[model samples]
Target: MNSKWLWPSIIAVLLIAIWLYLPPGIDPVAVPADSDSIARGEYLVKAGGCISCHEGSEGEGGLSGSAAVESPFGTFYASNITPDPETGIGNWSGEDFIAALRHGRRPDGSFYYPAFPYRAYKGLSEEEILDIAAYLQSQPAISHSVAPHELPAWVGRWQMLGWNLLADWKEPGREMNDDPEIARGEHLVRNLGHCSECHSPRDALGIIQYRDEFKGGEIPDGHVEAIDAEALNSWTEEDLALFFLIGMKQDGEFVGGKMEPVIEHNTSQLTDADREAMAAFFKRGLPASP
Candidate 1:
């Protein structure tokens, strides 16, 4: 190779390497399943809010396709959630499904980006996650690979490893208190519902500000005014569940950013009783603002 061509050739190789190493979206493979398992899987899928994240607003057949989720880091497209063996979760086993939710590890052993909300999901029970997995397996797989996330060159994926260390990831569940009303509400909002993951402000390392609790702030996906600590001090418990169920309140307008999808999927699916308990829990003697 002549010296004049050497630099050009190297540049081409580098580009090729980056392209090849980019994240891939292979739909899960299909497996043989019984009717009972499929029904259980359906319930699990609804509980996990699968459709809200996977399906794009403009996607085909109300299925997950190429919906782009804006984040503090960058934009990430939701992958196809259909059961197409080549493009969806058809091939994933119950164990593989469990690993993704509980451990946040893909079948290939690569870590999933936190954009997937496994941070909140890490608290889920094993049985709960397995049920979700079974439900996903029942869906029809669609063969569509979303575009790879384009992170800035300064911030490599390896940097996420450092963030994870500081995160002190834990399994998804909250300790129950003696009060049935408070505990039921707390469990619904924190574990299965995951409101704080979006509503609460996070520290630089991405841990939720426990002191601030439901006091909301600007999250990665978008800004949420009055969710900050000060606003919650004045609101009643009815305020909290209404916020989740309707995304707005009497005193303020709805700050619907990423939360729109959540209401559409998770909160909307809850029974009226569950929603009320959640409201009661949020209203538990809110601290007076300093």
Candidate 2:
């Protein structure tokens, strides 16, 4: 190498540039949740399928996340979220939690890697976000410590900020349709469900192809089947709803793999209305063409 100082100088300049352009400061605010909100939060957490991601491997960790999510960028370890002061998110204020979901940012305003599915979560209502936070507050504290992800050299905070900008990412306005049912369904499917995160393909930079969402793609492990209208045209809404319960198909067979755990921990717990909403969403298909 010509000089080690050359690389250090370049990094220092980049860091300084990023610091100068940092977003405005946001103070952490704590919002205490009532028992009712905590109860509701449990349901929302189940619907969001937090367990599938937060629950560690058989012995690695607990809801204090240790699950590794492998992606094109690199392997990412899910953060410890259980209410443990030192190792988990116990110290985070309710606003901190909300900001994490709304901005893909930490309390300090540092960027969070999108593996947490915050993009899908950004549109969630404040009440919903608070409710989820309340539920997290009630969870038993698990003091599991997870290691940091070793991001590739090219993916710094500024890189992620620019990437989000390219995708037109911004705060959610949360407009709805004339029909409340359809609106509710859309919210569950598009935001809380985050079904497309796994089913849809990502571009080279890891941004989800929203246009082709629900059209299956290869994930870190295996390929998921297309859940788009064209792909599921043969399956009626009724079929889709039933599948959510037990993974049974019209042919009397069952789906296995990653979906099995999803049914057990997430779908089976959802109310009938949410299930129908998801099915209805599938039948209607993407609002825009793939």
Candidate 3:
């Protein structure tokens, strides 16, 4: 038997498969010059909390993507997301943007570190993804070049394939009987808001454990712990809605730490009905604390 070539043949096949799975590159699309697209994108950007990691503050350099995101692995610098042709996503095609957001694959077919939260973003609809892209394109281009991520030698793009294989890549299926409010809450919480990404405990591979969904876990900094979503179930809907609206807990203490920015940039911007829906959804779905 020709056992000598067997290993080589297997390696070649695996390489070819990986290549086939790589996202294809496309030419950059022309940015839409309309106000409606920009407005929709603005709403989605806030809903997705893009500003928290990308902008840092309200003044200049918004979406320049220079913010530092610390993780258990290393410090990952957010890329320049502004429309700068040289340093940002200005020249990215709609497909290129979508590939990055939905598949975590760069236009050059490299994997983005999971710190970017593409796993949660993969659940977003195509229209929403495009709208976000359009909004980014409409922004004034910034020329900030971010430093590369400081990662361990073992952490590489190839590992992303294995991660995706093990992770829940598919969006959860919608139930036929889901009311509009429930559906909206589910979409906001699971996809755009991505609350569970922080709230759920993760395995060694940095994948969120479904068993611990919204049950609380250590944040990336290794010091602060995320509050369990189920814990919020004790609060009345009015209290929950008010908390989201004003960043004040039912106990009269102001929300602080990482959650402060989330409320400021994301939840505070949400509509009253949306906040109420989220409160109702959390109360109904999250398990009661023991």
TM-score of each: 0.74, 0.86, 0.88
User: Model 3, range 1-290, lDDT digits (tens) per residue?
Assistant: 39999999999989987775677554455545578878888999999988888883335467887677777888898888988999898888888878888889887888888888898898897778888988998888978778899888877877777788778553244452256776777778878998888888888888888766777778655544444555665688889889889999877999788889899999999999989888777776555667
Provide the overall lDDT of each model, using Cα atoms, as 2-decimal numbers. Answer: 0.65, 0.79, 0.79
| Global Cα RMSD, each model | 8.7, 5.3, 3.0
- Model 3 regions more than 4 Å off: 1-5, 8-16, 24-31, 56-60, 169-177, 220-229, 287-290
Q: Of the pair 1 and 2, which is ahead by TM-score? A: 2
Q: lDDT for model 1, on a 0 to 1 scale? A: 0.65
In order of lDDT, best first, we have 3, 2, 1
lDDT, candidate 3, equals: 0.79
The positional error of residue 229 in candidate 2, measured at the CA in angstroms, is 0.6
Q: How would you encode candidate 2's per-residue C-alpha lDDT over 1-290 as one tens digit per residue?
A: 46978999899988976874475354565555789999998899888888888886667555878778888788899888788888887888877888888878886777788888888898787788888888888888887779888678876765667777766553334566666666777777778878878888878877778768789977778898888878887888789889888889889998898888788878878888888878877777345333
Ranking of candidates on TM-score, top first: 3, 2, 1
- The backbone clash count of each candidate, in order, is 25, 0, 0
TM-score of candidate 2 versus the correct structure, residues matched by position = 0.86
